[model samples]
Target: MASDGASNNERLLAAARDDNEDLLLDVFDQPGTFDINYQDGLGNTALHYAVLHTSYDVLDHILSHEECDVDPTNKLDKATPLHLAVEKEDPEDREYFVENLLEAGANYTIRNKHGETAEDLVKPGDEVILALFRKAQADADANMDDIAYEDDDDVASEGSD
Candidate 1:
């Protein structure tokens, strides 16, 4: 049973690495498939592999899954999916991947083993990528502020009651 699960997990990782959307879908349909956050020996998750090797479609499928973790850190560099996204060589691909990861709630503030956040990994002269990180940070901060206000309103209403 354990080996079966391991094999399924390996298949999941391979599907993501190979951009095999069909195989990924098949694996996800199976009973007792690996946890969405399952890490290999190197602590790399399907999310990490998807970011590194997949085009938008496979990555999108992984991100759209309810249990998919957008910010899993690997063992070697403790790098999250967002970290790998920033390292994509093509500027267009980098921006697209980073945007999707952010939209899926990848935290831009997470630091890797090297103490570098995804923002820190942005290639020099890539102001557009940097701007995306800043915008995500701003949006997150605004959401936090809104939550705080809502909490305060709830407290006030309870006191009034």
Candidate 2:
């Protein structure tokens, strides 16, 4: 039974590397296929392979899984999927990936082996992506402030009672 699970996971990893979106979806939809965060020999989850292969469709499928770890780091560089997305060859694709990852709750503060966060990976010339990063940071700050305010309000009301 254990070997069966291992083989199934291997097949899933192969599908990921080949950009086989259909097979990936098929396998993931089945029962007891593999852990959503399963790591291959190189410490990469299926999502990491999808990003490495530039398979946006597969990336979407993996991300759609409720248990998927958006911040997984591979063995080579301890780089998350967002790190790879930031370096995509096409500017539009790079921005799209970055935004999607952010919306999915990707942590921009997680650093890689080089001690660089996803925001630090943005190229100097990619103005659009840079702007998106700034916006994400600002939004995050605003959300945190809102939560803090709510907490304070709760405390004040309790004290007044």
Compute each candidate's TM-score over C-alphas.
Answer: 0.91, 0.85
Candidate 2 residue pairs in backbone clash: none
lDDT of 1 by residue, 1-161 (tens): 12355577888888888888887787888857567788999999988988788556678888888888888899999999999999999888898999999989998889999999989989988998988988898999999999999999999999998
Q: Please, what are the lDDT tens digits per residue for candidate 2 over residues 7-72? A: 657757767777777777667878685787889778898777777777667777778888889999
Query: How many clashes in each structure?
Result: 0, 0
What's the lDDT for residue 94 in model 2? 87
Best by lDDT: 1
Error of 2 at 133 (Å): 0.9
TM-score for predicted model 1 compared with the true structure = 0.91
lDDT of 2: 0.82
